[model samples]
Target: MSDTTSTTADRKLTEGTALPTQPCSVVWSDGRAFVLEPPVWVGLDHRGRLARLTPAALQRQGWSHDKLS
Candidate 1:
């Protein structure tokens, strides 16, 4: 999904080794708020910028990153 400029609550949610809840707060490397569902992945790109990516996209590109890092 293309990134949007909108937002979510500032309330931080608890995270675990596993995927947390659906509709959890996922932010960009710049701290830009990005709300996405679980089964998602997060990682830094070649530029070292934090990226919010879906597992499908990551797999398609053969890129590996922390599931929620």
Candidate 2:
């Protein structure tokens, strides 16, 4: 099988590039809402700042992946 792993360089090139928008939301324990773009897993804060949701943070924050169709 061909190597399907993407290198850091490849990721860097695509990082911060806008893909097609698929807007969704996740909530904090305090009920703060964040707008997320799934498949990308990055989001925007209430003030409209970009938020990077790391795996560790997601688990710690009790986030579930709920895709909005």
Candidate 3:
């Protein structure tokens, strides 16, 4: 028998799931738009804009951010 417990890196986000990354929205939560770079963990409020975030905070949050060219 093998115990296949998934690691944080293996976790996927969906309904009822708490996403490690920020969610997308059409409106700005803080009524402002900001550019997000990799290595930053961001959270969005009711609006689409970035509500809160920490730079290079993904490591502590058990997540990794990658930038695609």
RMSD per candidate (Å) reads 11.9, 13.0, 12.4
What do the candidate models score in CA lDDT, each in turn? Answer: 0.38, 0.41, 0.31
Candidate 2 or 3, higher TM-score?
2
> Over the stretch 1-69, how does candidate 2's per-residue lDDT look in tens digits?
111222233333334543324567553311233445564346555466767765345434433232211
- Considering TM-score, where higher is better, how would the candidates rank from best to worst? 1, 2, 3
Cα RMSD for candidate 1? 11.9
Q: Estimate each model's TM-score.
A: 0.34, 0.33, 0.24
Tens digit of per-residue lDDT, candidate 3, span 1-69:
111222233222122333343444211112223234433434554455554445333223322232111
Per residue, candidate 1 scores C-alpha lDDT tens digits across 1-69 of 221211111112212222224566544422333345566655566566766677445333332112223
Candidate 3, pairs of clashing residues: 27-48, 28-49, 29-47, 29-49
Give the better candidate number (1 or 3) by lDDT.
1
- lDDT, candidate 2, equals 0.41
Tell me the lDDT of candidate 1.
0.38
Q: Please provide the root mean square deviation of candidate 2 (C-alpha atoms, Å).
A: 13.0
What would the TM-score be for candidate 1 when compared with the true structure?
Answer: 0.34
* TM-score between candidate 3 and the true structure: 0.24
